[model samples]
Target: MADRPTGDTSLPPRAAEFLELRPLLFAIAYRVLGRVTEAEDVVQDTWLHYQDVTERPRSPKAYLSTVVTRLSINVLSSARVRREEYIGEWFPEPLLEDPYQEPERAAELADSVSTAALVLMERLSPLERAAFVLREVFGFDYAAIADTLGRSQSACRQLVVRARRHMARGRARFAADRRAQQELAARFFAAIADGDVDQLRDLLAADVQLVTDTGGNAPAPPRPIVGVENTVRVLASVLPELGRVGLRLEPQPINGEPGALARDREGNLVQAITLETGEGRIRTIRSVSNPDKLTHLGPVADPWQLARDYRESRRRQR
Candidate 1:
């Protein structure tokens, strides 16, 4: 057992073990789900389920891994229903920043979070994705993967092979160099923020797409913006208004690529921006502004307080 933090909610032994392995579990869940929000939820659920178990395992890391993997598989199986009902295009929720412990190690991690890789993973069946992420990304052998997947080793191996073939066909291989990508992303945001349509156009791919998720709680364009020219125009038009609302953009990593976080006047996060790139140009811009999604990105304004404020503002307007 490890020493406990003062008033910590977790049992000392459990907390120490969980802290040691949480990052690895997060990595697995993120790859499997391709959505940071969903991945975190699965990890939390795994911890809860582990606490309920009466019997103790010899290796807590292995036991926790099994829990997260199984929970991810279950979530993926049921996710199709929700995906179908989602408004606009549904892209994976992006990460706020690179969580790698060392700057030198950013590249390898970035490759795993590339938009192309994530989109390709979405093409696979849940089982295939799980098998590939476990075996390829995390380096789990067929036997270990099979244990988590509840399949024979041979079956797991076949699943991974199929997933790899699918990815090879669909994804263009790109080298991961975080510094170069970040520099490009910085220029891209600056152009858009300045409403330089021509510059924005030059930075965007010919077939760029933009998707916004506002969750019907706020007014937003209801459809995806497609084509480079259209995307530029849309972004250029909106950039000014965002600033007017006390929102400023801060560069951050999203889904392993350079992204932007929108902060309020006091520097509270209100939105997250993720851009997908291909052939040295931006291919997609995804902005998540829905409060439900923003919570994971940063501390959000309290809902009850926001409602009260809105009511008071309405009264003042009258």
Candidate 2:
């Protein structure tokens, strides 16, 4: 156990303890709930409850972890209902920033937070997901996990086993090298920008699938666009329009994986496009266009920038 910090004179001891455990608390909340804003809210609620504690526990970190876990479970339960009524195939809000504190465990951290892992977790029961994250991702002992989840140690272990079995099928099956993945993503968008359908097909698997969430504000296939040929055709079909509107794709990391951030000519962000590759080819491409979800991404691209740039380019062409 790490040493608890001495609180500021103006602050309560419990408040100071929360600040010390905040990073881990937020990590637990975010991974459990899969929403940044919601996770922050959960942490805030935990602080409110902790500050009012008349009796401080012997282990502040453990106490705080328990509080966050319970709150997150409650949040996830209600959120599942709302997700069922969401406008389209919902995707977890992209975690543009990596928030893991342990540099030595960065790779492990990245694996846990990858879009695929987060998506697969949706299939898990709230208790199952909480058990896996606390034990597998955060290295909590089975006893600690049991205490946090209010389950028996044996039950906590069973939950983790069950969650792993459910997630094992979708775990990364391709190269784990980030550099290689980044190069592949760069080539993918380059091919898209050049309208090279053959190149796109070569980079995709036979069953390649694309899922886009525009939240009904922009045009997107209502259902997942699947299959190599069909996916290529749909993507290629958009190139002419993209060129006409001066929309360009730049390789950027999204949710810790190599991806493309679409921007207009003026460099405002339009979309966050992430790729999940396996067996040496692209398997899933996720493009999130929900404006409400992109607030943390900074400087949204003007919707009309494409047309404005097209007009300017045409003017110069003359």
Candidate 3:
């Protein structure tokens, strides 16, 4: 038996064991589900079950991972329904910074949790997503992955192969250079804040696409805006309003990519924007203005209020 708690929430032996592996379990769940809240829930639930076990497992790491992955699979099953009803284009919740402890697998880990990768994973079934994350990203062997998913080793291998085929087109092609990403992001946001259309256009890919998620709670384009010209026009028009409301831009690492967090005059987060760059030009931009998503990041202001204020200010100017 584990030690009793002095308080109601004191750590038990199994709970302590699970807590030690919390980072790894979180990485697995987040990779599988792409939502922080859901991922955290899965980890917590795994700990709850871990406490009930009368027999100790030979390897707690594998046991906890299995529990987390299965729980995430269950969540993902229902999450897909909500996603289908989601307003506008839905994106994975941005991981503001790396939270896991495996520095050696940093590159691999980043690719697994990247905005593009998560979006691509949405096309895969929950089981395939689990198999891919376990086998490819976390380096789990076929037999272990099979046990985790309650499938045969051969079947798990097939799931990984199928997932790879589905993701081949969208898989990452660039090496992550944190310094380069930060420098480019700095220049990119500076151009936006300064309203330098030409500079912004220069930093963008010829066929860049911008996707914004406001969940119909705030004003945003109803669909993805594609093409360099369209994206530049849209950014030029919206960013000024953002700036007008005294929303400041700060560079931060989001989902392993250099990105910007937008805050209002009072320092409340209004939006988070992440860019994908290649050949020194931005190819993709994802922004989340959904208040529900921003709550976990920090205190968030109403995005629509800012837009409304921008309109009123512009009217007064006229």
The candidate, 2 or 3, that scores higher on TM-score is 3
Q: Write down the worst ten-residue block by lDDT for model 2.
A: 1-10
In candidate 2 the C-alpha lDDT for residue 219 amounts to: 60
- TM-scores, each model vs. reference: 0.80, 0.85, 0.93
lDDT of 3 by residue, 48-138 (tens): 7887888999999998999999999999999999999988877888788656768797887887888888999999999999999998998
Task: Give the Å shift of residue 311 in candidate 1.
Answer: 20
**Root-mean-square deviation of every model:** 5.2, 4.6, 2.7
Best-matching candidate per TM-score: 3
Give lDDT for model 2: 0.82
Predictions in order: lDDT: 0.74, 0.82, 0.86
Pick out the ten consecutive residues of candidate 1 with the lowest summed lDDT.
1-10
What would the per-residue lDDT of candidate 2 be over residues 156-221, giving only the tens digit for each residue? 989999999999976766668777777778788889878888889999989899998876755666
Q: What lDDT, from 0 to 1, does candidate 1 have?
A: 0.74
| Sequence-dependent TM-score of model 1 | 0.80
Q: Residue 148 error for model 2, in Å?
A: 1.3
List the candidate 3 regions with Cα displacement exceeding 4 Å.
Answer: 1-12, 172-176
**Residue runs of model 2 more than 4 Å from their true location after superposition:** 1-16, 265-268, 299-318
